[model samples]
Target: MERMRIAVAGASGLIGSALVRSLTSDGHEVRRLVRHEPRSADEVRWDPEKGRLDPAGLAGCEVVVNLAGAGVGDRRWTDEYKRRIHDSRVHGTAALATALASLDPAPRVFVNGSAMGLYGETGDRIVDEDSPAGTGFLPELCVEWEAAAAPARDAGVRTVLTRTGLVVARGGGAWGKLFPLFSAGLGGRMGDGRQYWSYIALHDEVAAIRHLIDRDDLSGPFNLTAPEPLTNREITAAMGRVLHRPTLFPVPAPVLRTVLGEMAGDVLGSARVVPRRLLESGFVFAFPGIEDAIRAA
Candidate 1:
């Protein structure tokens, strides 16, 4: 890819921050869309919640990536927090898409963030990018989230929706919370442990995003997950093997329900999602299996 101007929303986040670093390291001119007042030449100001964004801020950028959203696992699923999760992604994405559409020579690509939760509980059924969305709160949220990018797509800009899975990483994310507990021998399966968990290493997640940005023919939703999906029990075993700890503890479904409330269903639910489109696009995974992803983290 040639050196180009790129703008990224949510540039301070786990994947976003890493992407900015990767693009900058390659000598791309990276502009960060910040909510606060611009503090430097590289920072542009925008407030997605309030539907605030200046089209000029993203002018001349060949590509724009939107990853801003409230963390789903950040807090217990209170009604208010759930609203934040939905609005943050839907509204923020709409704002960015509209701004991109307004550009005179709109960006060549718009890569927006989504999640695998769109499939809901697959109960061991293999799902891919073309699978119909399952019924549930998470699934409905994802539908709206991806639809929010219509402005950019409708304006003739190539738009790519990345339905990312659980990112295996040492940094912040659901997987980040697992290392300490598993290393301390306190980690265990969330429920029956039969539920499938589709995951990709943080390295592959970032690389896949870059791959989408570089491909002119790729658009629509692509599952950003590894080719293989493993069950929670298998993942727990991998964690124990990787950390050289005993996997003796097991948390029951009732216990998880009491602790995590509504979010517990997501923890225990199964979705055997795969990256059919990503692989077809020729994006390779650095950590393609459970054990490999665990070791990478």
Candidate 2:
């Protein structure tokens, strides 16, 4: 594959940082979109809230990836925080998409970040890229979030919405919180533990993003999850096994609700998502199972 100039928003995030490292290591030029003044030649200043970005800074980029969004599970979901989550994704995506569209020579591809929460609670039913959007705050938010990228698609860019799942990594994300608890033997199943979790290793997550960047024939939503979806109970057992810890306790759904408020619904909800599109596209996973993913983390 030939190296190309790529610009990434949210370059400081877990997946974003990993992507930048991967791209640069492969000899591709990477420009980071930052909110502050450019700290280096590779960084470009862009204020997403104000919908501002210098077109000249993005001129030579062949691909633009947008992963800019507020952390969903960072805090209690207050009305204020909910709005922050919504605006951060919708407005930020719109800002980037519009800017990409306005470029004299727009990027060939635009990979937008989305989440599996778009499917809401699927219980035991399997969902794929073609699945209809489910009900709930997250589903509604993701609907608008993906829709916000229409500008890039309308501009003839091969836009793709990556509906990522639980990314297992020791550094950050949900696994960052879980690894400590499991290591200390405090980890347990959330709620009844029947809820399914679609997970992927951080390495595989970055690999999938890179795969998307290279595949010119792919477009629209692609589920970035492991093929074998595991239940919360199975995941707890796997973590305990990997860490040589005990997984005997169970956090009741009520307590989760009391502690996490609205966010608890997502924790307890079941989403049996699969990477049907990715599999069909010939993209393979390095850590496709809970045990392997936990061990990798």
Q: What TM-score goes with each of the models?
A: 0.98, 0.98
Candidate 2 lDDT, tens digit per residue, 1-297?
698999999899989999999999989999999989888999999877556777788898999999988899889999998988998889889988888899978899999999999999999999999999999899999999999999999989999999999999988888999999999999999999999999989999999998998999999999999998999999999999899999878999999999999999999999999999999999989888788888887
**Candidate 1: TM-score?**
0.98
User: Best lDDT goes to which candidate?
Assistant: 2
lDDT against true structure, model 2: 0.92
lDDT of 2 at 16: 95
- What is the C-alpha local distance difference test score of each model? 0.91, 0.92
Clashing pairs in 1: none
At residue 263, what lDDT does model 1 achieve?
91
Per-residue CA lDDT of model 1 for 79-123, tens digit only, reads: 998988988899899999999999998899999999999999899
Alpha carbon deviation, residue 146, candidate 1 (Å): 0.5
